[model samples]
Target: MVTGVEAPLAVTRVGVVGLGLIGGSVARTLVAAGVDVVATDPDGATRAQAWDAGVRTVGSAAEVLVERPDVLVLAPPLAALPAVLAELAAELPRLVADGGPLPVLTDVGSVKAPVRAAARVAGLEDRYVGAHPMAGTEESGFAASRDDLLPGCTWAVTVAPTTAAGDLLRVLALIAGPLRGVARVVEDATHDAAVALVSHVPHVLATELLNLTTAAPARALALGLAAGSFRDGTRVARTDPRRTQAMVAGNADAVVGALRDATRHLDALADALEGGDDAAVTAFFDAADPVRAALAEAAAGDASPRTETVALGEPGWRERLVSLGAAGAVVARTGRDAITLAVPPPSPK
Candidate 1:
């Protein structure tokens, strides 16, 4: 009974575990969509906030499960998924009726393979579908969540090998229903590898760049003088290190594989420079420029240039960035905690 676009599943009540950014956003979205959402977070303040926002609040994930919600959305960080899934696996049978259908389970963990593997080990693979909404700012927690976060994003939905068809439909309905995201059904391993290349490795590179730059000289001045390009390239570095470390650890093989490939490309550029082969350097840029453009286009579905966010760390940072516009920086947002600046790739020539 997989109805097109209308979302075939009847998800009247949702129990969301871990009211972090993704979890909170999902909860808010579902509530706005007229679904009753019961959410749990370990933080008392967060629980109070969810209650304020008209969501039923519980103190623990186990308590959320006790409600026996129609669907359970686990939105914890990658490091927490295994234990969370294990807890859900143990609690479901005791709380749910013996012959009742298992509660549909889904997660917003970025890395999919490890989660799917954990679910399989817990014997909950048929009930779980892995989802990663490619959205969010460097900010974390429930306070930073937004209902509009997922709409324009490409959400990766992964199906485990043992996933039941109905279970997959229920997950799909959840993604399309309240999230309003483009549900791209990707294989679990492929999704992991894809994100490793596009996300995990890039975060590692951004962190490395920030570390190298700040560790050198006049750290404050260096950061203060950072242009739009520097800000755009290193934005991801501001994310919580614990979460990034969890992602890197969970998808170590894929991230390492991507890093090796990046190294090969960098080594080629270094070789070209050492040999003073201007043409070879030009060739490299020529190959890369269009690929970057294509990637941007594919992600955003826009012919317009891409913008990147930079934190306005100080009162005078706006004046500093606006000054760069006279020198080619395309600043977008002016008053937000962070500002968006259009940063196109360098010209190949």
Candidate 2:
């Protein structure tokens, strides 16, 4: 319903290449918007869940390629991004490039620099934009997918100078409609560094904290007693190891730098505790309290909800995704109707 220049184009067909938490959420949101969604995943059961959720599923990227969707969202792990681009390049050169050729392509990869580099190398840079939706739960996988996950999160949209304005607008529309968050335009490097600071580095710190608890004699008891604060502090540490590791590994330098800064902050906190400086401790809390308050306020204000509609071209892909059993059926509706898709529950894994 949010009108834009591309409103005339009307996103009829959207192809999602993954059925993980992020990908499944995207499809569900699009379906709620009345857009026909075709999706594929390597996991068979995942595809079935997606179908139940109402999205059409396809067997492979090749099948999606043949469908020639209006937009292709590459929602894969950071490490798999390059290979996915390669696969797309080999499988659907002409179709993707049709209409003078080239469909608008975007990705939901957390890391940007490497993805951009890989796309550039693969010669898909022109149509591709690097995007990161800064919202996630401690859970993952298709079962965890939820349309509302994106609505109030920051979604970074990175583009090179060569990216077309129309294409950029279309990408923004897709992200903004579902996320209801700011479509921040940042350079790839800046996006990577920022995510490293706010996301990747925190996950590392949380993991370390959790590890300390694991070695304690009363670990089981401690875990049992763990309540809201402990859960909040260590939530990210509970995300899928493979996904978190890949993100950290991909953005190594920035994460390391952030960790160094965090260490310095921790050292100062330790000094205050050792010195028994009540004033310093109070000051620390004073400073942190306001920051946290402001962040919460900002997040609340920025994560407003909106409805998005997406149109579909064919039924094959939707049927295939439904069969994966990753999530549930997505139906067309207006005004926040698509926000209820199943979200993966948080697991120790």
Top-scoring candidate (TM-score): 1
Task: Give each model a TM-score.
Answer: 0.78, 0.74
RMSD list, candidates in order: 13.4, 11.1
In order, candidate lDDTs are 0.73, 0.70
The clash number for model 1 is: 0
TM-score of model 2 (CA atoms): 0.74
lDDT of 2 by residue, 1-349 (tens): 1112122235677889998988988888888877878899878999899999898999987677677777789887766777778888887656635644455788888888888888888788988877888777467899989887776666677766666556665666566554354455566777788788778888898898799999999999999999998899898887677777877999998998888887887788889999998888777777667557656655554233332232222333222322211221121121221111112222121
Error of 2 at 183 (Å): 1.9
In angstroms, the error of model 2 at 174 is 1.7
Model 1 earns a TM-score of: 0.78
Candidate 2 minimal-lDDT segment of 10 residues:
334-343
- Global lDDT for candidate 2? 0.70
Where does the lowest 10-residue lDDT sum fall in candidate 1? 327-336
